[model samples]
Target chain A: MGKWIELQAVPGARDRWVRAEPFGGTVSFRRPEMLVMVDHAFLGQRQPKSATASGRLDPAAPYEAHLTVGHRCTVGCPGCYIDAREDGPAELGFDEWQRVLDKLASLGVFHVALGAGESTPLAFLIDLAHYARGLGITPNLSTAGLHLTPRLAQKLGVFGRVHLSLDGAGRDHMRGRVGFASALMSLRILRAYHPRVGVNCVVTRASFPGLGRLFRMLKREGVVDVELLRFKPAGRGAELFAQMDLTTEQKRTVVQKVLQLARRYRMRPRLDCSFAPMVCAAGYDPTRLVRMGLAGCVGGSWLVAVDGRGCLSACSFDNTAGALSWSDLGRPGMMTPFTNWIDQAPSPCAECRWLQVCRGGCHVVARHLTGDFNAPDPGCPLVQAQA
Target chain B: MNRKAKTKGSVLSVRTGSNPNSSSLGVDVTWLLGGGVLVGLLTMVGQTLTRWALTRAKSKHGQMD
Candidate 1:
């Protein structure tokens, strides 16, 4: 049988927002807010998008959202990014969360990536998922999987995908540490609850050695999907950054390994936006990356993360950039400060050929490592090469 | 020769020694091609309708996350 091209709605996205793809992309907007992610754009079949379209700003609502319900953790992973504690920003109560959800829905936001220090402990996580599902807002939850109970998983089964946070294959990173696990047990529990389970691996230097094993383990568990996240240099990670972060060579090697595994597994190999520099380092075509909507810095465009207090920043990782609430979002010339540098690459990036695609990698990573939010991503091969 | 061709009024006729089997075969081939095109178009219409129906049904309740 021949391959059939599908027109699918990006989950929890506007019903009108359709993503038609494979390798190929072109995120074209007919109206200011309507984004059509289709291969026809990459196929050069779309009507010419505005030459100066910027592909960044939209006066309308973001298509995706990241909402951290609370910041209290039962099983605090080593180097916890949010620095959750009893004193940290508390979880929003259901009513408060409802209001935030209401505002997002009113803005026509469709998908919400739900998380916290540990989502399972939130008493109303299931209710929140049910509520978001009721509103046609997809809730993609991620959790530190150690404390998950089957009853909780069963309740969560109704909404959408629940990603368990697992680092490396077995016990590569701090196996005996606080709350992090290999997540194999959580995977087993969730697989029984829902078929759409996936893992989120926080990529570190040790993770490089186990990419093959991690993918192999996931594949054996009837899981083919995982998102590789860069280890942010924040919270406890700030202290562990020098010890845990990948070196430039390791970054390139892991990228190459991911590509090899992706081909073998026929998987998309989902890498976080911060991994864009690594992808670039692996010698992938810049134009292809752009056409693929693999443009590294989409925090301020496609999605933004809201903290428990309802402050909307560019994404989950961007903590320092000033944020705006729903009321302030539509101000005359307001844009997330972190992404303001998206088009206007800072310093060294301004001199690079692939400036537009990589966008100097991740801002938060730079801020934490180089003490300058505007510094070029330290993991980027170009930064090291330029040096 | 397998067959000889002659034209009368811009219509070419193929003649074999005793049977005009090639001419009948040509007619059958034309009909086959025409039927194939008609079937293909109908199938496309049917597939499009099915997909549209599925999408409508999914919008009400779909399998996704």
Candidate 2:
């Protein structure tokens, strides 16, 4: 709600361009070109983003908040930031979720991303999606797509979009939880729907070689967009950093290759380096992706994770404050105390080149692996564009 | 903006690539000025005529003109 506005892509335009009136401007239509270009004052929201309208939103507005439905996760992926060592139960109840939605609504938050723990409870998620949509807020969910059955996918049609994680082409890196065939089957099921199907590929030692191949397959399969996520050295991610982390040269090569692949295939791939360069506004960015023209994680500040026992944590980053209940939030009257509980990250990440893009990597991951979320990121090599 | 003339000449040129006069296409400002001015004038006239016609029809139909 700061000085920024979010624009969403509507499916019908042949060129598929979205525009927004910059705070006080009007939209202009050019008949000959059949193109609508807002005056110089407006901002362009769609990609192959216009360089003219690029500027930072007022940082004062709360950035996007990433919320965890529960600490429950079945997968024991080695690099997972949210993996609970033991099988944690789904702690969030419908009433608590409703309250959270109401709070976000009151704040005029436009985007809310629900991840962490599996989001397979269709009835609950559908209600949540409907609630967000009712408030004209966009609700995005990141799922393994392991349980995205036909019926479930149809139900999820209410949400803005779903970004399914596909770390590699085969089950080689996915361990045993997400079979490649199963993920692809789910993709095929989702492709027949209205919402976009985005594939998230985490570039790691296990999946690096297959990145190009995955892009190729997505293009071959006629998928419109994909996301290349740079792996952060945090949580279980830190343990494997020695093997999974790329050298500066290799990182450059990977970015170049991915850029080339995207240009060649005309496939829209969002480069997510939220875990790199250490400092991130992930927990601070506004969730107005649908209302404001900005992208990336939005409304991540109002987000908090409440466990089955009603214990609160910033995210999955443990050892900071094990499990404080709702009563411990703050001075009796406060709403979002999770933002205060998270420690501020240190820099060159603070003054990094990609600071504007990646506010800071995940705090939980940074804290667990390096014991300091503010320190310069070791994974920043991947965030740099290959000149 | 000299290249603007070249592009216009290329569009109007008989043999786009084969013409030896391609290098001199930039000098052909006449086409650009003439065509551009004509377009502008036509747009104004077209708008004016459309408005006039609409007004006339409205008045004839005893509606607010």
Candidate 3:
């Protein structure tokens, strides 16, 4: 009988490998190229190494669909990423949203994150969540918590997780009028029925200082996980860049502070992939970075976003460049051409050592700053320091 | 400050300076540059300076300003 070992990709470099043995085998090795599987035969039976696995990517599907079911939002935070407005386009009908869910399910997507501007019709959101669950896709939601009534909260019990946006400790001022109270009420209501409740905070220069207090509040409110979203310069957020964007020194400080706070809190910390370059620039070791769950930019590669209009973007923040409409997906090949476009796209930061993880930072930031999505992210500490 | 007051202060202090409590005068120059107003002013100054230099050279060569 031969013992089997599994090899996984290293943290930063995609080609590097480390052996992982499940059956208590202690064989340790690092190879320049990815190794599929190797067996050691004890009965003198020789077996050829499986080289076919090297050519194939992971069999598990890597894509998660972030679907914006509605375009209207009433909260109107100052640096709203989607620039969601109360008067935004009406939401797609229930049937249309159901069809979209079916298409995502057919594509082997096991997870879907439902989002809206704010004021998404509660009935439509509930129906969509039910439809997605029927297809065996785990449904999650991100909301501003404005219209999360008790009835709506009961309906949302079907969701796997609910992420409430809490930009700062002071809710009303950081969010909008009555935003703070509403979010808290919603959190309390959701906690009564939902087991997995999380907070999504946007990290900016101003809010970065108060994150510890914010985390303490979330922990008190029974939040199980916290996702620290990097502030991207897009939509109305671009207007506040000068005031909110962290400088190189501030970025280093922010990363260190976040790591410290995350360690102190009981909540699980997950940072946006765009912040990977900042961690590397702060001189954190690769092992520490990987342990922090800071896998580089998975945008266009592992995740994709579908906006309220059924338009596809590499990520939610990247709603501008290379966006494909829902009509485009109806074509014959089915996402092959889209995936090829994302993979074949040229980026100036492709030669950087951290390219695999950073993926040239967020495309939205690059496009906003230099008018070219292929340009290196201007906010990247490495890019800024070099320039 | 109490937690509530501290949070309120932070929210009200979303301005362009390291000292969130300081008056508007503490706003940094980088913020101005980001707003593009400074860049536009610099471009205008550069254009005016070039025109003035050309006028001076022509006068030295006995041409009308």
Best by lDDT: 1
Q: Ten-residue segment with the worst summed lDDT in candidate 2 chain A?
A: A26-35
Q: Candidate 2 — which residues are off by over 4 angstroms?
A: A1-56, A172-175, A233-235, A275-370, A382-387, B1-65
Ranking by TM-score: 1, 3, 2
TM-score of chain A of 2: 0.67
Per-residue lDDT of A328-383 in model 3, one digit per residue for the tens?
A: 43243334422333344454455565554355666567777788766677887878
Can you give the DockQ of every candidate in the order shown? 0.01, 0.02, 0.01
So what's the TM-score on candidate 2? 0.60
Predicted candidate 2 versus true structure: per-residue lDDT over A206-294, tens digit per residue: 67777777877787777855666656554566667677765556554654565567666766555543432321222222222111122
Interface RMSD of each: 26.3, 21.1, 28.0
What TM-score does chain B get in every candidate? 0.40, 0.42, 0.41
Report the Cα lDDT for residue A143, model 1: 70
What overall lDDT, based on C-alpha atoms, would model 2 receive against the true structure?
0.45
If both were scored by lDDT, which would come out higher, candidate 1 or candidate 3?
1
Clash count, one per candidate: 2, 31, 3
Q: In angstroms, how far off is A265's CA in candidate 3?
A: 2.4
